[model samples]
Target: MRSDPALIGPLLERIAAWRAGHAGLFVLGVCGAQGSGKSTLVATLAERLTQAGVAVAALSLDDLYRTHAERQALAREVHPLLATRGVPGTHDVALGLATIAALERGEAAALPRFDKAADDRVPRGEWPHAPANAQVLLLEGWCLGAKPQDTAALAAPVNDLEAREDPDGVWRVHVNAALEADYQRLFARLDRLLLLAAPGWDVVAGWREQQEAELRQIGGARVMNPAGVARFIQHYERLTRHILSEMPTRADLTVRLGPNREVLELMPGA
Candidate 1:
């Protein structure tokens, strides 16, 4: 999908206003549900900022996923579901923290990249280098700044995936614990967070399905079929819904989107 100038214009204005209040290496977090266009918005914003003479580096949480071997070990030690890459417990939180720290310190750092098609991280030699003097860092992710659900919320199954795979709630509890601990430390680095709020969780599967379709057209190995897409999204459903219910008020700015993915309203964080 193309970038929406109508939406980007207002967002750029707000970001400029937000940047003015902060000094020295601003960290902006862009959060959204699957297929909500977080990467598109971040890319457009980074391009605009670069044209304005700012040194910007954009990173996706997807790139910080644990290596395949690491995740396999997690699966062996933790739960079988930990083998999946999309959830909180599957990320390399320490690496994320180190990357942000290095950037803030104006040190040259090589950012890691994950090869989703291969289900592993690319070699360090293949990684991209972020400039030492970046003025702004844009970190985008599906679950960035997502708060953990309470114990009561985890007692019930949200879908068949949860009901069958996580019947005892082991996986959900593990994911929530990661959110409360390591993820919280990582998110605290954000000076401002912009959330692309989907209309509701019900639309996420359709949006993700559309994304997989596009990927398939391009012959992407990671592209999932319709049924696979449905099952895959179940891993994200709980936190995505929690962010929908919680992050709008907590984020520095939130761009609400309708079913058609058009910007509906922009709300300032509380």
Candidate 2:
């Protein structure tokens, strides 16, 4: 997706203005569905902010995913579906909280990186270090600022994956509870939040398919194919729909996008 200067320039101005007024570390949350171009937008925003002489650092919730072995143990203990990442319960949120606290304190912080191809976190030695005094922190992820669904809402399965694998509701309940607790605490640290609103959930699969195609072109390993992409996104269907429905009014800013991933509008939250 191409970054439109018409859109990004104004947004950056707003962010810069907000940063100027904020005292300490200004943490911004960029929330979006899978393949909604959040990572690209955050990277571009960071580059622009840096060029404008703002000390900035960016992190992804993807990077805080639980180690493969940890997830394996969770799967063995909770449910087999816990083995796959993406849900709230699958993240090492304590580590995420610690990292954020460190950044806010202006301490040199080692940022974690997850290797999706290896389905594991990169070794600590390889983790990147953030500058001690990053003035702005951008945390981007699919589930950032997502709220827990009420237990009644979780009664019905959203898709085949849940209907079949989570028939007993054990896994979904576990995920929702995590969102209510640790995830809420983690998100409470954001000074401002933005939602990259997708036109609809129906377009997510197609966009993700495009991403997988690009991954394949780069010889990326462990990339999902078309069918795999379909099933994999099922893991996120419930919360993706939740954020699409709920986050517009909840985020500090919302960037509405069309299926082509082009920016259509920028809106301030309630």
Winning candidate number (lDDT): 2
- Residue-by-residue lDDT tens digits, candidate 2, 68-153: 99999999999899999999999999999999889989987999999998999999999988878989899999999988988899
lDDT of 1 by residue, 131-185 (tens): 7788899999999988889989999999999999999999999999999999999
TM-scores of the models, in the given order? Answer: 0.96, 0.97
Single out the weakest 10-residue window by summed lDDT for candidate 1. 1-10
Q: In angstroms, give how far residue 151 of model 1 lies from its true place.
A: 1.1
Best by TM-score: 2
Q: Give the TM-score of candidate 1.
A: 0.96
